[model samples]
Target chain A: MKAFEFLDEIGTVNTHTMVLDKGLGYAYVEDALKITGEYFDLLKYGWGTSILYDTEIIKAKNELYHSYDIKTYTGGTLFELANKQNKLGEYFEELDNLGFDAVEVSDGSTVIDPDIRENAIKQAKENGFYTLSEIGKKNPEKDHAYTTEQRIELINKDISNGSDMVIIEGRESGKNIGIYDEKGNVKTDEMTQIHENTPNEKVLWEAPQKNQQVELILKLGNNVNLGNINSNEIISLETLRRGLRGDTLGKIQK
Target chain B: MKAFEFLDEIGTVNTHTMVLDKGLGYAYVEDALKITGEYFDLLKYGWGTSILYDTEIIKAKNELYHSYDIKTYTGGTLFELANKQNKLGEYFEELDNLGFDAVEVSDGSTVIDPDIRENAIKQAKENGFYTLSEIGKKNPEKDHAYTTEQRIELINKDISNGSDMVIIEGRESGKNIGIYDEKGNVKTDEMTQIHENTPNEKVLWEAPQKNQQVELILKLGNNVNLGNINSNEIISLETLRRGLRGDTLGKIQK
Candidate 1:
């Protein structure tokens, strides 16, 4: 039992918490996962880091996460790089070799025509892997170039193209990207519009900040899937989702 | 040469950046150290995390850190607990068994009388560990009870009692503790007073937040030693120290 169990509330909220593994060593991954495996479900080897790791270590970490019933995948930037380089074929081959249960395709760092992005999603489906494709850009100026209408259209296209889930790009920093502002605060108008436009069940909001997570939980309900979660914030995020934290306490529903 | 050399005025900054390694496995430590070992001098097994790992894994991580010439130590909270539980001797034996060349003694989470706290420092020195002791309580109410004079006395007492370094507690959150306020901003008056009263070279201020780090660096110069740095922030912190980042760019002497 927790030390302050008297302050707890009753609930069983199945939260799909995704941790950002930005180039962790297999040993670090093993040790951290041992303590937190039961608390988190998905792990994204953050943005192009998998490309930098040895194939043996990548393979080993995949096996380790899988043993704990955790699904592992590459960051969307890796997928975007693969597509931008016309190396999607090679990417899938490597993903299979790496034992990844899933792969993330994104246009976060590149400009992919909507039709081209859709085709990439369909191809990922044909490869027999769970597909999570993201919609946004990395640079703040170019990211601001995207309208809510454009983002909604892209989300629909990816879903129709067979994406299992669509991730909103928050990047690692989470600020000045997509729905977040320069101060890392959510632009609620666009956020609500995107939520209304998409099937919320298939959407994963990349909330890397506590306030963002709290706001998303308050607005979207307890079971909302959140991504770009730091490795340390796994349990904390779960607590927020379950109203175990001060920010969301007594406000979130069971 | 750094990519943005023209943006900086390089000097003998001699910065000490310490990163936390809370229960990281051997291979993971090796892999992470490959990317970040250049940026840190000390590695802390965060708050009682040393007790969670196998003795063998702890030894291996210590050896791995040593290969990079990074000294390894446990968090101050662990030392406090050991002292509180009357297992201080056992803790030192375990530290030796784990091959840690350094250790921290802090009363962050628990209370130790000034005499006992100083004795702990002397005992750690006699045991051949490079000791760093921390001031300030973990609980906010208890911490606020400490006057600046008391803090100064504690700093001098620790150094005189054989501590290699003295740390002002910033806790992992870096908020409402030590010199930081509720918004994680540094209380400038208290901070400057501490520096004025204590030997700055013998002190490592726990500035976990970016703004707190910027404040301390701006106040104490770029060569100022900081602790409790997250593993990911090593490169970013280095950039700040060298005037490479937008925040500290052109402001730092180095």
Candidate 2:
């Protein structure tokens, strides 16, 4: 029952869009999902925000997302916090009890031994949860230390370690970080190199900016996996992927 | 009944927070209002977006906002569109019929003679609608043509011509336009000069960025009228006003 059905040019591309849910009210999410849910693939309760909200609300939100067939996971920061506390087992248990069907394993905010990172990924899979592992430091200085080759190695390692998908670190602000420059423009050479060498289909780029989303979609086709999209921009991003927006209009191939 | 009332140091300062609504679903508005309606002073259907949705939806949204005692109006772009089409009277009647009790009289996207601008403000008042006149151009090049004195003159004239409040243009992005620089930093000297000359209470600054919001709150007190705030940032802005967030914590006087 979508409006302008005749103009639905995006077609079935099997694109993955992971929306960032940073502490939104359940009713708001419910209503928003009604408008843009079918386009959504995954939902991340943004970094450490899951711990802030009432447990009942988180459970309700997880169930709501599940009803829409969107996989729900706590942000990587919570996992890092739990690892810091040496309560990884309890963290996994907490996620299950809260009805989250997915977990993101990331050492962005804190350090985790390579074995622990791999084990956590495997544990999440064993625990009947879809695992998304991220590879990048939250600190820009540390993030910059990894060469394109190093990033590729980490992405591959995570996938081999049983991650269903590995995410590239773009953070919420897609500026001067990872494959983006100071003005949030993509570093095309590095992007090309990474795409060529990595398991491209399993890699989700955290493109929080509109330009980044447009660039990625145009370069890699509309089926490109885009993550960290703001809740408000969900419908807008779908339009971009479909060439309905002016930015991507007449550019996306049906 | 608010959470952590003991931590609320803001002490109920009189403030006006105008949120930009770009075609939100009714259920989303209902849910959002439960969390933030009390904090909202006005809801603007951003930049001719009212024309895109069905009239029934617009009327429903206006009613929903009015239920929370929040005034609802279409964006200035709609006014400019009406002026361009020479449908001012029809536009005013349509707004009333559509259940919008307020109208924004602005020349952001198009030029209006001083007499016409003033007449529009007065006409809106005569029609029994709350009138808010905006005093900046939407295009940066055109906006830059107005000097501080010229801008101040417009503000004074708009108020004298019967504008309930005059909004300074910050156009969604709050960057390199008006009082903001290319980096979205506030131009302190220009801002100081404008504030000193204007009828401050009747002026609502459209500060969409976090830094701008923080800087304005710190300099002009938490009670300063702020417009063009994104819908999602309503509660966050309220927190900043009340000194609840880290940026404004210990900054605002109790």
Candidate 3:
């Protein structure tokens, strides 16, 4: 039913695009979904943004995303903030009341005991919410201290602790953070090492830049789950995955 | 009514924020404008993106933007493309049918003789369109050859030729091209020289970066006409103009 559905039929496609929705208005959510809803599966109302909106608008935006079968969740920063306030229970209750079907557990911006991190993941699952846990410090210095081996071990542990997916931190800027260099280019050696060790299906890499997205797709095949995509680039990214764009055209094969 | 109208009573604010809309869905525009429309004065369909969408959708989007009292215009690259193809007449007619009230003239990606550039500006004005003529080549290598004095000369010529406003090229990246270094920092010497010489009222600076926006506001006052702002940053830019944000807070007076 897509405009160029035949083009995508030429290859085997494996894509689970997770778009970041940072305080979208309900009308935008309603209308934008008609064009891009089918291409994305997960929607994250970006860090601490939902907290700034009224309960009514947040609820309305969540309902609209859900109407498209796009599972909606609050950003990891919100969960961290809730934990810092010792209101994790209140957070879960409020998320359910607002019709969010998932929760992101991240310690990127804060510190929590390992036991607490594991328990939060388990608790979200117990509450019938899809739990996504993130690994990597928000600060570049702290994030860089972890070797590829350490990140790999954490990804496996999070999966065993009942997280449906584990996100690797690539903040909105995507520069000098995690596997990206200062110029927003991928560190291929680190990326390859992690790719070889981690469960690809359970990991979502936040590739916010176009060059990063292109490199990830070309290196990991078209099905690599990419997160933090800007809303406007949804269609353009779809083209890259299907070899319809100049960057990936005839270069990608099933 | 704004969210924090009570806070901005300290000073008079002069700002004309122009946002770049590269093919947004009509629904998103309708919903998003409600949240941030009051902060912006112009909406530009970025560089040839309007030619990619249906004529009806383009017209509808223009109407939606105009409803918020935001003047709508196509990117100058589209004008250059049409001029290259010898379709300037058809392009103007189409823009009229699509309800666009303004047109941009530029020689960014192609060669336009000075006479043609001036005529294009005058022709657009003659066709009942508000004209915005841009100075600076799209190619950084080519753009760097022009001295600041030459740029000032072009700006004066464009205005004299009936361009309602003249834009300085910062091209979405805001780096190493016009009054910016490779790191996207403003070159103060060149900027100061141009500011001192140019007609400030008729010039729009396409500043796509936050640092650039902050610097311009600090140097030229909050009322400076700034273009190419991301849609999400409209409210944030307004806050900067009114000295409400941390960057410019308490630094400016009415």
Candidate 4:
């Protein structure tokens, strides 16, 4: 039973939240899971940080997330690095050995041929992994080049190509990427276009900022899938989802 | 033995880092300490977050921090809240019972008479607490009203009134407050004036941004005291201090 349980009875719906675990220690993950394990649906080991720690630690964290029935995967950068090295086969094998149940396929930091990108998604799904494909470049200039129509088309194509979910690239900063403006505010017109075209359940917005989360939730309803959330903000985000926080309080519709 | 020890063989010095603990779990604190515990000198329960958690959990966290020889205190907002209720004496007693060995005396969110502010610092010290008094308003507009000269005078006075450390408030956002501009960049002239007039060891700057941390480390020679650091960035800040991160790698002064 949560504190303020009476106030949070409304707006409790099936929502997907993917938290970024950027090189947190094993004990810390365990501690956080005790409180907020049920709130988050996916756990992402952020951008090449997994390679910095011992393989044993990574494996342990994966197993821990799995215990809570949460899907876990390495960041897309690691996958991109493996693809660049022509070691996708080895990467899939290592991911399985490391206990990862999901894989993020992205070309944010690198370019991949469309055929190869679709193939990566198929291979990840074939290997019994939850495949998440991302749209948008990490560089602001590169990301801004993609129109909303282009983003929506890619999101739909990835969903058709066997990605369990398509993640809009907000990066860790959540600034000037995908559907967000330079100040980290949501480009509502762009967002609505993507939402109207894509399957709502299959598209996860990588909203790392509070305003982004609130805006996404209010615009798309409480069940809007949000990703790239900082690990510390898990409980806080859950409150926002349930309209317990001031931002979404009395504003969330069932 | 830290990983990448070879790359971090330079710029080691005695420094004070106060991390903001905005309600972390027990195992999480233990896990963080296992990795970067020795790096931080103080742990502040951010704002009124402490009052929101159960007293037992707060006490346990305080004890946990103490075990690592890191002094723990509630944020200045809590101190001000207590002061508003005329419960300063009770606040000190409760702090002792909760295992906190430090207290922050400040009027960031409320007004405090000059004599009362001095008395609060003296009372905290008399209670054998490591007293920290802040020198900025929580509101950006009000904070900007303080001239560098006024800030310097207050800081010097706080130290004389028995504050173990005088903090220059940068808030959690670290923008448009104290020495930071709207873009969160350091106001070099204002920073220099404060640095020149105050006793460096007795002053702690609240710099929650990476750029602010890097700038302070480079300008103040790695030993400059920093506060309001995000708990997740403890290791990252340690890396910056030791010239391990790209931002400060070749720039840190001995």
lDDT of each: 0.80, 0.85, 0.83, 0.86
Name the weakest run of 10 consecutive residues (lDDT summed) in model 2 chain A: A48-57
DockQ of 4: 0.09
Better of 1 and 2 by DockQ: 2
Q: Compute the lDDT for candidate 1.
A: 0.80
Model 1 lDDT per residue over B26-52, tens place: 655677777778888988877655554
* lDDT (tens digit, per residue) of candidate 2 on A8-100: 466756978999875577887887888888988999976654554456667888899999999999778668757766777878888888899
True contacts kept of each: 0.04, 0.08, 0.14, 0.11
Identify the superior model by DockQ, candidate 1 or candidate 4: 4
Model 1's C-alpha root-mean-square deviation from the true structure amounts to 8.8
Residues B116-233, candidate 3: write the lDDT tens digits: 8888887899999988889988768999999999999999999989988889999877878898899999999998899999889899899999999999999998889999998888
> Candidate 3 lDDT, tens digit per residue, A1-254?
22111112334366678898777678766777665677788999898888898888888888788888889998899999899999999999999999899999999989999999999998999999988999899899999899989999999999999999999999988999999989899999999998999889989999999889999999998999999998887765775686544346456785
For model 2, fnat equals 0.08
Question: TM-score of chain B only, all predictions?
Answer: 0.93, 0.97, 0.97, 0.97
Candidate scoring better on TM-score of 1 and 4? 4
Residue by residue across A1-254, what tens digits does model 1's lDDT show?
22112222445477677889877767667777755676677889988788888888889999999999888898877887778788999998889999998988887778778787777788778998888888888888998988999999989878888998899989888898999999899999999999998998889999999889989999988888899998877756765676543345446765
For model 4 the local lDDT of residue B244 reads 77
Q: What is the TM-score of chain B in candidate 1?
A: 0.93
Model 2 CAPRI quality? incorrect
Q: Which of the two, 3 or 4, has more TM-score?
A: 3
The estimated TM-scores of all candidates read 0.59, 0.61, 0.62, 0.61
Question: In model 3, what are the clashing residue pairs, if there are any?
Answer: A14-A223, B14-B223
Two-chain DockQ for each candidate model: 0.06, 0.08, 0.10, 0.09
Say what the interface RMSD of candidate 2 is.
Answer: 7.3
